[model samples]
Target chain A: MKPTSLLLPLLLACCPTEACEGLVIERAWIREAPPGARVMAGYAELRNDGASTLVVDAVESSGYFDHVMIHETLLEEGRARMVPRDTLEIPPGATLSLAPGGLHLMLMQPVSDLALGAEVPLTLRCGEAVTETRFPVSAAAP
Target chain B: MASTDRSALILLVLVAVLAFALGIHFARRTAPEAGAPVEGMLWPDPPRLESFTLDGADGKPLTEATLRGKWSLLFFGFTHCPDVCPTTLATLRETVKLLEETPDFAQQGQVVLVSVDPARDTPEALAGYVGHFDRNFLAATAPPDRLAALTGQLGILHTRVPLGSGEEYSVDHTASILLIGPGLERLAIFSAPHAAPELAAKIGQIIQFLQDSP
Candidate 1:
């Protein structure tokens, strides 16, 4: 019945979660794969503005692809190998780049055709916070 | 008079010695050094690839003979690979374009992409994947056991990592591109982080060195 309590509930309802407010995705793109290609890779930069570290646990793009997983390319002994990553942690006030030959998203079993210049919706999940973003399908980088 | 003659003789001997030394130095300088090695990590004796068979994009049998008569740039990767694989192929495409620009180098070499994931990369799929990069690009794949015979000889490494649940999995493979000589011999291994122009120049230098050598 208190005015402050009512205000608090209203604020909480208005802003259900602020966890992803500090997470920004820049230059997001999914490499346009060849026809009949089953897999593609997505690249982007994730910037965290909050005071605490943010962890990206999973990526999902339904209907367009079967699933999306985080993967990193490791160069060792003059060889490059891709390793699946369970979680990617972005330090507070820092930007984590997911570029070619580094950290990227392995998109698998595309359900439909993906053309260049088309935008694909992607969802990033970390803990209880979920962020929605769209990535443009671009030509594979040289 | 005899002492004067002796001094003249000594001067003649000194002149002869100096002339001989100068001749030797000029000969050594003008003559090409034996085994003037190429710039890359050229194997003193290039290793011949073991006999193996795989399906080419055109459905023809890819064997040692397929690689004969021309230089080949071979890369072992999966079509699913996004970052390293495509970037490398694109770089190679540019490299090939550069190579083609050189006189007599055009059509003297080919770029091949060997699929490490045969389960998913059928010949048709590979054709589509490789053709996307360059219409002339060739793609091939073989069963795991057959692939081992070739990869083992080349010391190429690849491993499969499961992507959790379902039958989906990803392959981690060596990113180095193997240079195969015209004789089907393994010439050099170009490591990753490859630059198109630099790699093309290195390849040209090596090829020129080989052609110029006896």
Candidate 2:
């Protein structure tokens, strides 16, 4: 069932999936990292704009980092595991979010220094019409 | 937005009570002579817990009773950790959520984030930062000398370094999750790659054993 009106405010503030209608990415950001740390995480909401379902197989970015893959964080017996997703799909007019403490993107092998405020250019490949986006690396979420 | 406090406190006491009983159970010399005794395996025996009274979020007294009769996961970290602290804490929150959904999985322990970067992580800052993950988490810190003594005995480590920002700095420290059981003993431990379900399962089984014993 679609979330109720009670969720409208949150959806707008957080996901904004409806606002982006027709397959859009809303508010993608790289949660800040520690000095000299190799791994970093990304979060976003992918909203499907049409009546048809959409499958996002892979993502690409330019001049920031090369490899970006979908992964989910799970804790089993006190150990954290990162499970990779071959692809993520969203139903018609639905938004799928890559959030902290759950499914997210692991951006590894940075091509250059990801200074604060630098936007990582991204390309989300969903079939032929790829949607482009940017994720600004900012201070750790408050 | 839910409270992990009252329920967690209740569960913690229940677990701790059960654990104390287990501590006694393990201490007895045995091979049941006349009775069909309850069956169990000791994954590992726990270490004797020492008592401590220290300051908490408010510069008030916090003591060994602070952990009495409850299983607590204590993590030594600082607020400045841009990655591990938050990530690990969030994982603990998820782990707690997973336990809640488990059938009869009693939430007997608390997740305590103690700031090793005491110079910067004032109790208020520590509390605020940890509350961002889950409200019930205990965010505590003490003076550098005392903090060093407590953490050192626990095998936790911390060291400060100069950041390129001239006066500003950063700290590197040991990041291990310590499991404190009832009777205040340090129980089974977990390293990085903190697995939630498996950890919960083991703790659940431990709790069950603690509950079953007289």
Candidate 3:
């Protein structure tokens, strides 16, 4: 679902805090891709700090990339298949990890090359609540 | 006189059968011994590869002869693949380093990145991508049909996945790394979640075992 129309207000409400009230992001990193690479992958840990479950319905990184979507690499029948994830929910007091060779943020069509140590902003929407964080670009996991 | 001829025919048949049995016995004795079981590797019956031609990063033909005389480690992936491809190539780099450090380990091998997405991964782009990981690493690709011919026999599967629209797509591909023997035969299959140390150790042992066999 294209939730950008509604996410704009949520983005305004949240001031791009790394440690927020409901949900917090930790150890976020964007893997540095080779020059002329059209796509890159980002990973982070999504932790639910509040009593209720945090549902991330959509993701956006407009200025840096054409679009961002949650994708998973599944090893099925000896092949790696990229499956898009529309919604992801984290239970209360639980942490969900997006990592290499697993669930990750598939950032497509970068406006320019993301150099090492560069930070890219990303926004996540969970209904009316929104959380934003910046992920540092690195060759390996941070 | 007819009875005498029949006896001679029976004697000739017995001598031929004895020679056949001896040949089987000697051949079995001289066959190579299988190595110990290694993690993440499957040494099925090695199959001879079909002759196929692909263009290397330098626009030269990379045929089966190019892979002869060296152990070839082949991975099928696209340069645009952001997650799994980089992870695998890095793992392979680490694996190669471990192999080099070990003494008596035959380090005669080449790592090749065979692009499944040739439409986007031009020869120059692929060369740059593989070089970022290691300068010695090689990359090659061909037209879709030629690529399919090579991939089909090696059991490498790849398909283009469209992401949204407007000239954006990702490739879903086989994650296993293939080992080609120096004799141009498919040797082993290494499954994913590859650890550098384990992979290097296993490969070193497998190669040594084969060389020392018979």
Candidate 4:
């Protein structure tokens, strides 16, 4: 979705975080990681259905991995460096992309083997409201 | 007096010539850079790592013996790296051809690649990948731990990062080429922005120097 206009807020009021009762999490997913590595990245399109702006700074996953952090990758002087992003902002109706080779969340220290075709439970906590989603670990596209 | 002055002059000339030859030999060992000699920057006393045994793509054991008595160009990467890995391999292939044009490059050594991603990079996959660049270049990989150990010893980095589908991700790694000498000891390292002609000339020069050395 290009993420523009909305009769969306009315529909999302159904599921809102306890702390902040206005914003709603639309969708989230695990992009896809190189096999054999314990770490994985996640992205979400969090929509603020409320009147005020919402800032999301923390995320967590409990299926197998726990250490989740927001980060960005930058390529400078022919070198790639990863840095943390303070908070993710949702100004009412906008969507953010935590895509490949760019801004994303880090899922570290896998507790067990998270195989393909499996779902990883994720929680995005901004303010008080925590939205939950099941992110699927996709196989490399054929 | 005449004999002494004449001998002194001859000795000075011989010393100057010898120094010049040594200079040329070392100079050729350096890769030519952009519009300049790559020897412009030479890593001093490049480390020679202890050798280890690993299996080639054929599932046959490959060790230091395979690297003997030849000027070998060693690279570490995986088959899945379609972008950076392939580009570097192609460049190295060109480097091989450039040296071959020198008429005796093969008399020096061979070019080979060792897969860092051991799990997916089977001997068969490696053979296919390396063959895409050049058939003679050997490809090898063993266990994941062995792959990690070799890369660690050689200073390569491959870390998996998270992607959003919850468990999907990618690996961030260092892409550099390693030069292995006749004794299977690491001779030098080549970093990013590898230039073919320069590398070819430098490798050719190193081979020549090794050939002439005792």
Candidate 5:
């Protein structure tokens, strides 16, 4: 059976696999950092397409980074601080946009240099479900 | 040449002339009235900064006097900062590019990144970090006490946060960009989130306002 056009538009942005059932990821890209920079940031927009809420508990980039964590850059009392998150909940039909000064993925200890236009595979761990996406390296949001 | 080409050329000239006139008129109109806020929080009586020294990327000592003779945009962050530091620096670079496009605006504002993490961000490291964003950008840092003397006057604050038991730590510092006048006085404070075009426009307006002042 063919999927309707209404559903096709939403699923087009996600990885074309059965595992990406509940969430659709779009505009996923990593900011290109200066040479020898230990840490870089990745931004994306996540949309929960399922009826139930999706909880993203962990993120991993195989063979690309030593560690990956969800972090938010907060402006408090005129100061900038980075806070780590244990989990992120996306309600049904809700969209989460990860931007520069706000929610972002802390890509730490890149195994090698991430040149512009290079694509790195990233996986998100949601309880009983997992989805994968490729984040392209760019100087700005793609 | 064809008659259509001639007509097109004439139209271009008329449009150019009108644009030039309108540009002048709008520039004058945007200049704020006496003692009015230019962009962000414009200080009615901007305070003159005290003398303090920090290590510059050029191996020279950067003092309050070094910021004289031009407008300076100072940002306080660390090299280890993964997100906001680079984001802000890139925006500052764009701001300078935007200002350069204005006619008769010969002197573009200088951007200085003051590293609050002195323990990790040395002068050499500062050079590499800032030079990546912009080669013309100035990077400076000093020991905790010396740095405190300068940041204290500017109302900037910074504190170190430990990450587990490792030596890794992050410094939470002020995110606001400080605008300094040619006379070394605090001009205005531009709080985030910043847009490059608006920042450039506001700085140009402030410069014009100051110049037109008695």
Candidate 6:
């Protein structure tokens, strides 16, 4: 078989669809917790460049944690509550910000200690498209 | 006719002078604008807090008496909380740093965290949790009923939701930080989206107002 024919097949197989093409992760960071701390929070800005809305249904970090949940901290009637979210939608041409004291990822049961400046691989699942990213551990502002 | 006109002019002058003096007197007596940093609603007459006994981080008894002779900023949260609790505590730590720069603020001010999940937040756990933010920070907890006694009076609220397996759970609590006067009275509440320097400035204003009050 010609090399051009082989290359065409490989490109077609890799670019099956545009669902995962335009998703970008920016300023992704995980709050560094003290040694022996079991839980930590992650923040980031997820931007969707596709024409359709991107819905993130699940997240995973294989070597670091077995469970990752999306949660929002709501301040209602002067009370603050952390509510679990099943899915977060990133509208087309818009950015979803996960900031402090707002929407964040609840990372639990760390398998090992996470040090500052270390980058951890994170996989975000949205429908059939899975996007892989890295989260850098950073210290909180004093 | 000339004497009559002169008497009228003298009466008008006297009235004008009396009005000017009254204006100065009222201006001095009027209260100053609140200028609180947190935009909290100030109580014209702060209500005295009811007596309730809770355990302090050091195993000492904490009651209304603990608030006497010092200003305190009280927050309700749990050690297991991953986001809001720690974020608020960090902001407060920064606020304390700003306050310490002001004279007498370091000596007279304190930050206390009251755990809503007393079951999981033992004195030791709370101590470690709060100490991570600041060494001088204090933590406390009470039984459900006793905790209600204080939270209810302050209009603070909290609810626990299970995480669907095992004993794991999360507690939703009031994010507002309450300011307690040196006399153990409830003065104001600092709501969420709090800024460190703004909170510190408000604390200074509140302290000045309290000290200047009769």
Q: Model 2, A92-141: lDDT tens per residue?
A: 97889876657777676577657778788777777545677888886544
Query: Model 2, range B1-214, lDDT digits (tens) per residue?
Result: 2577878888999999999999878767464565756443454556655665556875565566888777777887776554456667767877777777544444566888888777777777766677767888887888887676567667776667553335544456665687777677776566655557866776677667766876
Quote model 2's TM-score: 0.51
DockQ: the better of candidates 1 and 6: 1
List the candidate numbers ranked by DockQ, top first: 3, 1, 5, 6, 2, 4
Question: RMSD per prediction, one decimal?
Answer: 8.6, 20.2, 12.2, 14.6, 14.2, 8.1
Candidate 1 chain B lDDT trough over 10 residues, lowest sum: B36-45
Model 1 CA deviation exceeding 4 Å by range: A1-19, A140-142, B1-40
Model 5, stretches more than 4 Å misplaced?
A1-20, B1-41, B102-108
TM-score of each: 0.80, 0.51, 0.81, 0.49, 0.81, 0.80
* Model 3 CA deviation exceeding 4 Å by range: A1-20, B1-45, B102-107
TM-score of chain A of 3: 0.84
Query: For candidate 2 chain B, which ten residues in a row score worst on lDDT?
Result: B162-171
Per-candidate iRMSD: 1.3, 8.3, 0.8, 7.4, 1.1, 1.5
Candidate 2 yields a Cα-based lDDT of 0.69
Q: Over 4 Å off in model 2, which ranges?
A: A1-28, A32-133, A136-142, B1-45, B101-107
Model 6 misplaced stretches (Cα beyond 4 Å): A1-19, B1-41
TM-score of chain A of each: 0.84, 0.77, 0.84, 0.73, 0.85, 0.83
Residue B61's lDDT within candidate 6 is 77
Q: Which 10-residue span in candidate 6 chain B carries the lowest summed lDDT?
A: B31-40
The DockQ scores of all candidates, in the order shown, are 0.51, 0.06, 0.53, 0.04, 0.49, 0.49
Displacement of residue B31 (Cα, Å) in model 1 is: 24
